[model samples]
Target: MKAEFFTDAKPLTVSKENFGLERGPLAHVLVNAMLVSDTAKGGSLQYQVGYQLVYKPDSPGKKLPALITTPDMSSFCRLFLERGKHYLLGGMLDQNGGARVDLCSLAIPWKNVTGKQHRELLSYRCD
Candidate 1:
């Protein structure tokens, strides 16, 4: 697996942490993903395409779901976060001990995920 740092993703308007005495506010997270292929073919190729996204939000009493799409761009999902949701939010450390959110690869795609609709994201990550 390969990865790169992305700084151009969109994010929601909210604070960082949920409840806190420390860094209780959240920032934004941008994820840029790419796929490469060695063998070129029709409907396929020397795969080299990418996406420029915005960011993710993790504010108090506020949670938003990711609109996850597949590599083939076939599937689409939009999950929403609700209050009293439990999930992990990771990021960098600020000078004021605040949070400068980093792009996390792992997180419960849905906080209190409702239906069996977004299980694809979990499978996508396994690829």
Candidate 2:
């Protein structure tokens, strides 16, 4: 399974909200991330942490790639998401219609968690 996140943040632009286009600055990079089942042994999430990086400095250059990792050596307190679950992300945007989003953290943390490293007792699927 796979997941998708969207945002309008300008983390890549030094202008704070602009992509350096109005200011004629170099471009920063952005990436896409998803939450999937971490099907590793003794894994609590049954989900894998993955990301799709956006790079290349050119128009639509290599639209990033989806990345995933096993839940090996992971713990609780970081279960901002679950397996087969779809998350909605938002952030600042550029004038040229590009999103400068950050994928390393969650704007909202999930309440269904304990001090232990684990996900909620459920599995999800997309439409």
- Give the per-residue lDDT digits (tens) of candidate 1, residues 64-109: 2222222221222212222333333333322333233222322243
lDDT of 2 by residue, 20-93 (tens): 52211112122234434555544432222232222122334333223322233335333344444333322323
Task: Give the TM-score comparing model 2 with the true structure, all chains together.
Answer: 0.22
> Alpha carbon lDDT of residue 99, candidate 2?
31
Largest lDDT belongs to which candidate? 2
- Candidate 2 Cα misplacement greater than 4 A, ranges: 1-61, 70-77, 89-104, 107-127
Clashes of 2: 18
